[model samples]
Target: MTKPITILVVEDEMIIGAKISLLLTKLGYEVTGIVPKGEEAILYIQQNAPDIVLLDIHLRGQMDGIDTAREILKEGHKTVLIYLTANTDEETFNRAKQTRPFAFLSKPIQPQELQRTIELTVERILVQREVNLQEDKPLPQETNEELMLLQDRIFVSSKNKLVKIFINDILYLVAERSYCQIFTKDQQFILSVPLKSVEHKLQTAQFLRVHRSYLVNIKAIDEISQNYVFINKKAIPMVETAKEELFKRLNKV
Candidate 1:
């Protein structure tokens, strides 16, 4: 029998942490434990390496969530991280982004959003496991129509088969109602999933949501103006707040 995915909840508030644990259990995942501090979380992870970690940003201990994530990586843990934060400030967001979390969940979490995020994360984790197992052998032909997201690349369905697209190659994504269009330098691909779903899968700091309908890769941007960002000579609209944040992120001098 295949082992069930294990998760650890590192939330300071016991009530909220317990609620999350209950939800995970209902979703058919094994909750390793719920710790209230980053110190205990690190110790628990050392003892029982969970497949995923749901970490809260503002903890009651010496280390905050971002610091804890750094320590986890420093210790060579392969567990996937998903951050929980009520604070949406740019400084906190940027610090958390530096750790490269699998996803970010706001406080007072919605059950459906949590479920979708975990499900997508699990898919990526399982795909990575398969790739690791087959490292010494040839990869099998892709027959599934579902898109597969990896750490640095994604397998997108195209012409009845899956095609590998490096994440860096993707310039931006535009949401068209229920569909999302991914634009690269020389190609474009349409996905059946919504923009939010794609954003959840992208854990890198390179991509930023410039508007409700657009997610742009900062590295691929050619120029930024007051109202728009230019990529490959294509102008994409940006919100005021997003533009300000982007300006702060870029080097001015």
Candidate 2:
């Protein structure tokens, strides 16, 4: 079974903490524990190392949420920190900003907001995992298994299973050594094949080779500059020749 994302809730109010834990559980996350103090939160994190820490900025102890976050980073723990704040002054906001938290949730958290925040955080975690894998290990050449492409969608391996990704949903692709990372509107997939291989299989006029390492969908282009094309607000490098070709394809006055 897939291991669910684990979280540690650090809220001083027992009732609020319990409510948050229950909500998290219902959202399919594993709540490791709920601690009411920064000191206990730190101690629990030192051993548990949950994937995320939901910290309330105001606490009874000497260490506040920002202080706890600093200590966690100081201890070399790279966990996503989400701050919960009922009220914030300039000084507290500055201090919290210094910790570089993933997000901030106001008190009386709405279920939809919490769910959206966690979902975005999970996507970030997945992307970071792919980057770490690329840095830590050498990517092998094309695997024996090939990506299954259909008229409108493609299937790629993810978590030991084939996940369907519609062709129209693709934003762009980035080549890293022998691996290609396929990007869609909300998710990303890494395929053990070269960029050229995937491009050939795509076989569509909508997808253009914007750069040596990038293949972008024409419909997803938000802006085009001299040296880059923006897709979903992400700047992708573009070569001069490819830029000329892209301009030729677009209708301009």
Candidate 3:
């Protein structure tokens, strides 16, 4: 069975702290600590690492909640810290956002918003776990084509290092000299391998050869116009020869 997401609540007011704790408990989370000040909250985090920390911006102690959150983040804890603030002004939100909390809930929290945020946070954690699993898995040469379909991951040699790549995150591949340049949603990597060898390994129907140098993920193409395919604002060359096949595959969708 999966353990409930343990949480620490740091709010100065006793009534608000208790109310927030009660709400989280009702939503199936375990409230590990309910402290009225930032100092105690930091101490609790030092002793025990919770899955998420719900921190109030204003606290009655040596440290303010924003500073406390930054300190906690610097300690290398993967805890999802969220901000609970009454200030909704653009400047206040901008300042709070600089810390990049998982979520920022307004004062007098709405149950619907709180529930949605918790759900999103948990789902994100699950996705990270899957990525970690892929990273930990061993690399094997003479690839198994079926592995990409089953695991959505690949281990490739890049600059003499084993690099783990989540295949679903990859949007396209471009062939460079003795290498394949992989482009994902957030980053790009170059792995040393022949383009043909990669195409052989990733022969799944999801990836199509739109051009001699480009293998594009069919699902990632956003639009097509005049031999140019748009993928999330990035233009990918679409040859007239491949356009017929591209339309054929897209029409089947």
lDDT of each: 0.82, 0.85, 0.74
Model 1 RMSD, rounded to 1 decimal: 11.8
Q: Which stretches of candidate 1 lie over 4 Å from their true place?
A: 138-253
Q: How well does candidate 1 score on lDDT at residue 187?
A: 88
lDDT of 1 by residue, 93-116 (tens): 999889988778889988866886
Per-candidate TM equals 0.57, 0.61, 0.55
Q: How displaced is residue 6 in candidate 2, in Å?
A: 0.5
List candidate 2 segments past 4 Å from native. Answer: 140-169, 172-182, 185-253
Better model by TM-score, 2 or 3?
2
Write the residue-wise lDDT of candidate 2 on 1-253 in tens digits.
5346789999999999999999989998889999999999999999998989999998888998888999999999978999999899999999998998877889998886688678657755665567676658654433337899999999887766779999999999987567788999899888877889999999877889987878999999999876678889676768799998898878641
Instruction: Report the number of the highest-TM-score candidate.
Output: 2
What are the RMSD figures for all models against the true structure? 11.8, 9.5, 12.0
Q: CA lDDT of 92 in candidate 2?
A: 95
Error of 3 at 233 (Å): 28
User: Positional deviation of 117 in candidate 2, in angstroms?
Assistant: 0.5
From the highest TM-score down, the ranking of the candidates is 2, 1, 3
Arrange candidates by lDDT, highest first: which order?
Answer: 2, 1, 3
Query: Cα lDDT for residue 183, model 2?
Result: 91
